[model samples]
Target chain A: MTVSTLPAYPARSARLKRISAEYPHALGLLLLAPMLSWIAVFFIFPTAWMIWQSFSERGLQPYATILTSAIYLKVLLTTLKICVITTVGCLILGYPVAYVLTTARPSTRAVLLILVVLPYWLDFIVRSYSWMILLGRHGLINQLVTGLGISSTSLPLLYNLFSVSIGMIQILLPLTILTLFSTMVRIDRRLVDAATIHGASPWRAFRTVFLPLSLPGVYAACLLLFVSALGFYVTPALLGGPEQTMISQTIMVIASDLLDWPLASAAGVLLLVVTTSLLVLYSRFFRLDRMLGGMAR
Target chain B: MRAPRASLAVNGLAGAVLVFLLFPVLVVVLISFSSVDFLSFPPPSLSLRWYRTIFSNFEWINAFLLTLQVGALTALLSTLLGVPAAFALSRHVKRGQNVVNALVLAALVTPPIIKAISIYLYYVPFGLLNTVPGLAFAHTVSGIPFVVINVVAGLRGYDRDLERAASIHGASPLRAVLGITLPLIAPSIIVGAVFAFMQSAQELLIAMFVLGTLEKPLAVKLWEGVRVAIDPSLAAATTSVTVLAILGLVTVMLAGRRARPTRVAVQG
Candidate 1:
């Protein structure tokens, strides 16, 4: 609907000529110098160097071990497992919320929608700390359970897989809701009505009509959440024990604590490959642009 | 149009989800007032002892200041770079623009940890590690993509005929841009800046890589506090950060409300 409607103001010859005479293409280049230079020096160079480091032994046996090592392979599998679980969890939790946001009255839903996304404004560290407080042995869950006379144990809440997953789910739910809401909002309610009018059950109507149409958004959101979950650092580091260490944690250990840049870069490149491949698969199934724009709604 | 029951169900579920999402943050604020040193929720006795402890901590103070500095620098650098790149994307139909867009989008799509590790490797050479400037630059990379995406969306929706009309009336391209385009997209620019602020401020993984012990950002401090200290003082710091975030969100929401009837959907 939007793409075909791009307004093309017919260029008047005189203005075009005059603008060409004084366009200062050089000036545009000059204006762009600082930004371009910064990106080149800070972003591009670093990425290139990381790739280079991945292939060479700077401080370790760095011959780009594609099939020689099992550690990177293990980290890759671990990242994938975590990401997939987080994505599925987000979908199950977020879908209902997105449905609610789309179906509710605009005025009432506005506050809820704002609340849904408000956490994005909060610092990640603060959120992690809140989880730390809530899931710690002396935190809310333990306190509540003990107060209720359910058990005397502290519940083994913090520094575990459960804590890490919960913290991640908390961070990721808003994104899933937002994306799902976008696509759901655009779904024609009349289609669902039509399906029901044809004697389809409410579930059948939704399953056949609404779900298929919203798949683009759902798939996109999952892609986003999964890819993001792959790179999680603070949540896992703060909440998870050493038994549940993620690739990001492992990379940090190798790079900073262990001082092994080659290993770190290799790990990074592995993560990048896995995430990018997933993203490509997602884009193949859905239009990323539509998902992005739709979700912003 | 009148699916009242379904709408109600949605509303009810949404309310529950919102509570679930927000409950932890609220709990932290509640726990900060506990009289005991250990974090205890639904406090047996309330006091401002943790607040006092947080205020007295020099590490917290230094980390907070450094975070502010980094956030400010991130916002500034992102705006400077992003606005023009956005302008180019919106105004011109250049070759390989899609590819350029994809690359910029990649920054957002790639896992933050991967970007951090990649940038860390990049930082090792030329001694860019453990510096305020290097950390700021890294944050800027993450933050700029948001700015560009938002500003581009804003500009894409704008009426280019207005620019044509202005230029035809003897206004130079530079004048047309400054006098018209920039002012028109001011709301998006503000949104972008706010996003940049929040993103850089909240960032933990990359900041962990680039900054040194003396230059640790607040997120790093919070991480250390939670992992090692795990006390009410950390809760106090959490409360402080939450309040600041709420303030920023409120300001942005109000500004967005005043600027226009509906926000120009600025996606990243």
Candidate 2:
């Protein structure tokens, strides 16, 4: 959708373009320098520095402590748990939306997709903040609770595992739905119809045929969402209780609140390693370019 | 091509989920216009006090202006870098492009919290943390990828023959690109820049880590409000940003007609 509709650059003039004829790579290299150097300086160099600082300060001790200590391990495990839960929650909420999308009128699907995009484009911080407003002590949820006489006082909705999950789920549900919808739309409905013709119930046809066909999309969506959920800071920071401390927040504490750079860097590096491993796994099994390209559409 | 409508029960459940996803946005807008100080569902009465309050207050005004400047600067810088790289990947280079793509998309893969801390480490000793340029620079690392992905997506389908024709007609390669190719991809460029701008506008985690007293993006200010107290003024700021987002999204969807509206679609 982005590139194919436009015309291509099919030919170069026979006359040597003096500037590029001298060195083809020169122009290309020059074009790439700014972005490459920007990444090198701001991203690569700093990440290198952090890893270096993490090791140099205590000579592998920060990594060791994180590995050995139950405290750090608990946070790491909890972070993993949160990411998993968020992914599962997204899948649960998303399947119906995706199914609805495929079944809807085209105009209706367009509107549904746009509404999903609205929140998806919204800032993560703003979304989290809105959740705070909607779920806080004096928030809408609490007001409704009291107004409905369900509870005399505000339910503890704002700061807990529940709020954190709510915020993360809200942020991720659209993503899962879109991915599933895109994949679901491409499924050959005739296969399901064939199953129904072969004495399968509608539910049986869907479960056996459509569900199996859509597993790839589900896998891709879960992988993407889980990786993102692992690093979620805004939702957890704003909506979570003390028990909900994810690895990202723990790193922030080490870096900022506790002012322990080495531990922070070590933690940061651990996160990078895990995420990069997932990405590498993605590239290994699936063509990442296509995954990303399809994702773009 | 269509089957009978799915069960009514399925539609009912789906509608409920859609409402859940959209509720926060709707709630925020509603609260932003509330007359009462207390945060309540549906509001006690309608008023523009929160909206007016944001304009009159110095901090809110300052944060809003700062956010706008940072977002614009990030957009400009990212476009300057990302468009060419997109062209290079699309037209010129091929062998090491995967490595390039990986590096470009690294920011998306890595969590924002980690990016913030790492950038904070980079900026701290140089005294660049919290400064406008530094913040904008931090944003560009993430923003440039969007520019690359977007512009490259636009580039994939671009007709090279147009440039070829221009070059054959006595225009230099540079002029061919400048006049013909660039204009053709102008919508993609604009869409990329809009994405970049929106990235900086809504970014707060990095802002929180690095921003000094001098510049507070609206997101950061709102975060402070969330941390310190629940205030209607925060809702006002949120509503304004939401309006900007709507405009930006409309531009993006129009520009790259079929591209995913948000990077989070992939990121999530």
Candidate 3:
């Protein structure tokens, strides 16, 4: 009995060793299969099907319609215009906040960072609703204006490019600040001091030394904001007027209201092209991990 | 020896921007207690009537419950899927890692509107529209990125020697990971789960396409309400969401704090 058990122990140990040796490779594939399959089925396949549907029946007519029709062309241009506005608006409002975050004490920086990011957790519908309450005719802004005798009549603040820009900027400002702060915090302050010691003024030291280093962050933020802004659906839909209609809203209208799947798919494909190209350009310059890391924090 | 302080103008600008960011959400919270029916700031009188209404109204209550269910389901599914993929990406895969990474993160860059339309079309053929599970699955696509990103960041900072130590002590590889690795990364997993839940809760675009009139999430209900009317009830609904969001943010902050000491211990 003892001799038989001794031989079985060696066999069992060998089996364990073999399992350990071969496990990681097999395990990795097993681990990845679920998510990879889910994405392929739900995301990749659907996107491909949509693209195929675009040309399945009309055979380029939808593309021609988009190119030839005044409405589609105008909507595309308006979408671009709004995206540029949102990107610029976020930069102007967010840069100083990020700069201050980098310069502040750690406690103050933590508080400030929380303030910027807290809004990100709130729902877009709620944020957009808040904007409506503030910008409506008898809303908060008008109430303040009227109560203070600042204007005889309420300002048209609710449904325009200005309102859309404000709402979008507010929504995307946190992303801009976080991205900029992540990069700005990494710049060695001693470099600026080195420049100042070399006889440059304080502002000049920053301009020459720090600003160039921060450009990569600014470019990445703008690209991210611009691409994100291009996909504005809720904010623009809730805040903007007819003339301010974006391509996303146009697509929804086409798909749901007009019931034109092919036309909607064509427009979606067009939006996809522009966004993917910009992202490809971004990937060429900056690592996506850095951007995602900044966001996750 | 000290750096020059940020100028007064910069501080003031930043302060103003912070105020701009906080004021709207604050107004929504404040207006939810309005005594009157209409939406207004600095309400004539404060009351809990809207909150009571939200709790009592069937439509509002149903939507809120549905939103919570979907959020929970989405968080669970994404984590189960994302953690393994994150592990595979960070540890095991040697070849085609970049391709896999790109594939995983692709959902992050895809516009939500495009996702909504395409998924809506895809679901129609499969009869997946308007079901809670279907909605959760649709949301899981977006939720995967948050979980993967947070978990990967957590894993990057993790000390691999600890796992090897466990293995040397006669633990199987799987046992080492379950007992040693996962416990260390629990904070990240929590943060990821919270974000995924909040994202699914607040999501409206895909929900709008997938859900029908009979069953709606809070976001869709609020959206439909805002477009049609501006009332204290909408403010009440918005405030409830605001509270949930604040709670989620606090959880993440606490998770970050909890993660710090473990990291310090690992380094030391």
Candidate 4:
């Protein structure tokens, strides 16, 4: 009787284990349900609704108006211009920093990295406000110039294209540096040493071997910087005059000040389209996971 | 060795860029202590008047508290939603993984202004506008990507054998996960929480639309102040937020250092 009961219990437990093992996929589905549902309701639904709202009232008329209207077209162009400038500025400023970070000793790299990343973690409002303090009429730059007798009066440094560009570039430089550094660090320094041994000058070796290898990183960084700069609102709004109105600020004004929901939605859709297309292109070249992973580190 | 001249140039350029990066931050912190009414490079006398102003003013205090509350809520909600999703994505749900990933990360790719406007419109019809929960929910959509990215990374380095061992030792699946996996990944979750909190706290565009008139977070309050006029009080508010952020960063770094050894030991 004892032997028969033991065999029966073993058989029951084996069946239960099999059932549980088979249901892992179902368990996964259950686990994913909450986040997926939350995203669908809060993220996807609103986005689709906004797109629908854009075309609901006037069909494609709003798009046509945006295309034809001088103000809207100019704002879009200005946004593109600022984004290009900011991207270029970040590249020029960030490359040396990234290169230094990749080649520096571990201890020095840690401190340099912290200095670069500290501003990134700060709020845009803080950074932009800081820029205002430095660029305003009584700002440090103006004060320095006036005190040195270089100029009799303060320069109109705040609320201009120059200020806008400076603020945006400063804000975005860390992102560019980090992205470039991630790619640069992966490159074998031995390759450059090889070129040098083979009678190539250091500058020539960098230009021929290292530069080509690092171009992909440059492309990726520029894409990210341009995409980010395109969506900028706070820096431009604070540091720019009416001339530097970005597509984002325009959307805000249309939505809030003008009370033009369809036009605003249409403008938003256009901005979304441009940014999404660029990112999609970016993902085709580089894995999104790697980019995000690089940023997190 | 490479030429000394090139190395010196690189170091000099890097140093200049670092100074450029940090100068504005330094200026802001310094100006916050000014005794003068107007913006100035050098404070004639150092004073706590602006800090006192921020503390004494009801609106500023209200905004600060609201921002903290929203940030905390966003961190909690995103982590609760994101951790399980990370586990599922990394370990389970094999089919359509790419599609799911893209869907999860779509928020990060989408322009912030688009997100702000869309959420603002959606919330208006649902009567969710100007409510803390509403704004928190909006922020959570953005926050989830940060949480998922961090937690998924943590899970990738994790060994599945630990869970298998737990099960073999008669621990149920849920019990094993709760007892072992969660604790092991707690540092990642905490870091994710920090990112989520910072994202929510620093967010201005969405908060501008979602919490328009009745409620204001610190970002919005600063935006208003900066738009109207530049004041030392604005500098004081920014300084406070920057200091808080620095503390958060320091805490995360320490936590990461402490967790590193334990993680390495477990793997070995």
Worst 10 residues of 4 chain B by lDDT: B259-268
Order candidates by TM-score, high to low.
Answer: 3, 4, 2, 1
Order of all candidates by DockQ, from best down to worst?
4, 3, 1, 2
Q: Compared with the true structure, what per-residue lDDT tens digits does model 2 show for residues A140-198? A: 77878899999998888878888899899998887688767767887998898889888
Name the 10 consecutive residues with the lowest summed lDDT in model 4 chain A: A1-10
Which digits, one per residue and each the tens of the lDDT, describe model 1 over residues B1-268?
Answer: 3356875776677677778898876777778888987666677898999888877888788887888888888998899988887776555534445555555656666777777877877777668798777888888877777788778767767887766666556555566677766767776777777778778887877887777565778887877766677567877876776677668756876775675433222200
DockQ of each candidate relative to the true complex = 0.40, 0.38, 0.46, 0.48
Better of 2 and 4 by DockQ: 4
Residue-level error in angstroms, candidate 4, position B170: 6.2
Candidate 3 residue runs with Cα over 4 Å from true position:
A1-29, A146-150, A292-296, B1-6, B245-268
- Cα deviation of B193 in candidate 3 (Å)? 1.4
CAPRI class assigned to model 4: acceptable
What's the true lDDT of residue A52 in model 2?
A: 83
> What digit string (tens of lDDT, one per residue) describes model 4 on residues B1-268?
5788988998899899999998887877888999988878677888999999999999999999999999989988999998898888777777766666767656765778899999988887799988898988989988887788888878877876776666566555566678777777777788788888888988988888888888889988888888787678988987887788668767876876787678545532
Report RMSD (Å) for each prediction in the order shown. 5.0, 5.9, 5.0, 4.8
Q: Which stretches of candidate 2 lie over 4 Å from their true place?
A: A1-12, A15-30, A102-106, A136-139, A142-155, A185-205, A286-297, B1-9, B91-93, B156-181, B248-268
Per prediction, fnat is 0.44, 0.47, 0.51, 0.52
State which candidate, 2 or 4, has the greater lDDT.
Answer: 4
Report lDDT per candidate.
0.73, 0.78, 0.83, 0.83
Per-residue lDDT tens digits for candidate 2, residues B102-212, read 677676557887788888887878999768888888899888877887778677768777766665556656776787777677677776787788878878778887785
